[model samples]
Target: GENVGLHLPTLSVQEGDNSIINCAYSNSASDYFIWYKQESGKGPQFIIDIRSNMDKRQGQRVTVLLNKTVKHLSLQIAATQPGDSAVYFCAENIMEGGSNYKLTFGKGTLLTVNP
Candidate 1:
C-alpha cells in the first residue's frame, strides 16, 4: 500500500531529565487529539489527549499541549527514564457530514534515553 503520515526523525534525552516532543497537525477541522508511545516491537500505547476546545491536559508524569491556532501539539514527559525511550505519535480525529469521520496519525518521533 501507499505510504501515509509524518513524524520527527529522532529525539535524545538523558535519564531523569524531562523530555519534550512536538507534533504538527494539518487538519484544522480536527476536534480530538491523542498522544501515543510505542516501544520497540510493541504496539502504540495511549498516553494523553486533549480536545480542540482545550489548550492543555496533564497526566501522572506527562502533559499534552494543544495550540489550535497554529495546529501544533506537544507532549512533555517528566523524569525521563530508559523505559520512556520509545517512539511517540500524535493522532487527530475529525468528524465530517455527521457520521463521516477519520483518524489520522503522525509519523512518530523516536525518543532515545541516555544514562
Candidate 2:
C-alpha cells in the first residue's frame, strides 16, 4: 500500500493474490478521484473512479473505495498477475465555480507482481 505522506516507490505482490494500493488527497473539496496504472514508459491508464457522493465502486476485477471522512482512496485489484505489475497513481479533480478545476496526482506506488 502507498503511504499518505511518504512515497511508496514499490509494492511487491504474489501472483494469484489480491493487491491493495492506497492514496490520500490533500483537498477535501475534491469531488472526483481516479486510479491509474502506468507501465514502464507508458502514460497513465485510467482504471477506476469514484465520486464524493459514493463510498465505493466496483469494476471488472478492481474496486475503488473512498473515505471522505479521512480523505483517503484505495484501489483493490483481484488476482494479481504479471501483467498487472506497474506504477499506480491516484488523481483528484475538483470543479470550482462551474467548470474550472485542476487535476492533481499523488506520489505513485510501484506494484511488482512476483511470479
Candidate 3:
C-alpha cells in the first residue's frame, strides 16, 4: 500500500499463504500493463499482462488486476514459497503512436516469503 504517496517497497508474507503487491501509475494514456519477476543476473521474467480492454487476467498461480479509474495495478500470488522471494515490478505500456509504444516501469517491491 502507498502511504502519503510513498510506496511500501517491501512485502513480507508467510509461505503457503497468498501475497498481494500493489502499484500506482501516473499515466492515463497507458495502453497495457505487465508484471515481471526479476531473475538473478538476468532480466525480469514476464509473468502476466492485462490489456486496457480488460480489467483482470489470470495466469498459472498469479493474477493481475487493473483499476483504470484509480490507475492502479496489483499482482496476487498464491501459495507463496521461499523461492518466490524476489523483487517484482509493474510495467506500463505507453502508446506514443500507432504501432509505437514504450514501456515505463514502476518501482519494484521486494517480496519476502517467510517459511
Name the best candidate (by TM-score): 1
Candidate 2: which stretches are off by over 4 Å? Answer: 1-8, 96-99
Task: Give the Cα-based TM-score of candidate 3 against the true structure.
Answer: 0.88
Q: lDDT tens digits, residues 3-113, model 1?
A: 211245788988999999999999899999999988877788999999999999999999999999999999999999999988889999988788898989998888989
Sort order, lDDT high to low = 2, 1, 3
- Deviation (Å) of 49 in candidate 2: 0.9
Return the candidate ranking by TM-score, descending: 1, 2, 3
- Cα shift from native, residue 50, model 2 (Å): 0.8
Considering TM-score, which of the candidate structures 2 and 3 is the better prediction for this target? 2
Once fitted onto the true fold, the runs of candidate 3 whose alpha carbons sit more than 4 angstroms away are 1-8, 97-99
Candidate 2 residue lDDT tens string, 54-76: 99999989999999999999999
**Model 1 spans with C-alpha error above 4 angstroms:** 1-8
Please report the TM-score between candidate 1 and the true structure: 0.90
- The TM-scores of all predictions, comma-separated, are 0.90, 0.89, 0.88
lDDT of 3: 0.87
**lDDT accuracy of residue 11 in candidate 1:** 86
Backbone clashes for every candidate come to: 1, 0, 0
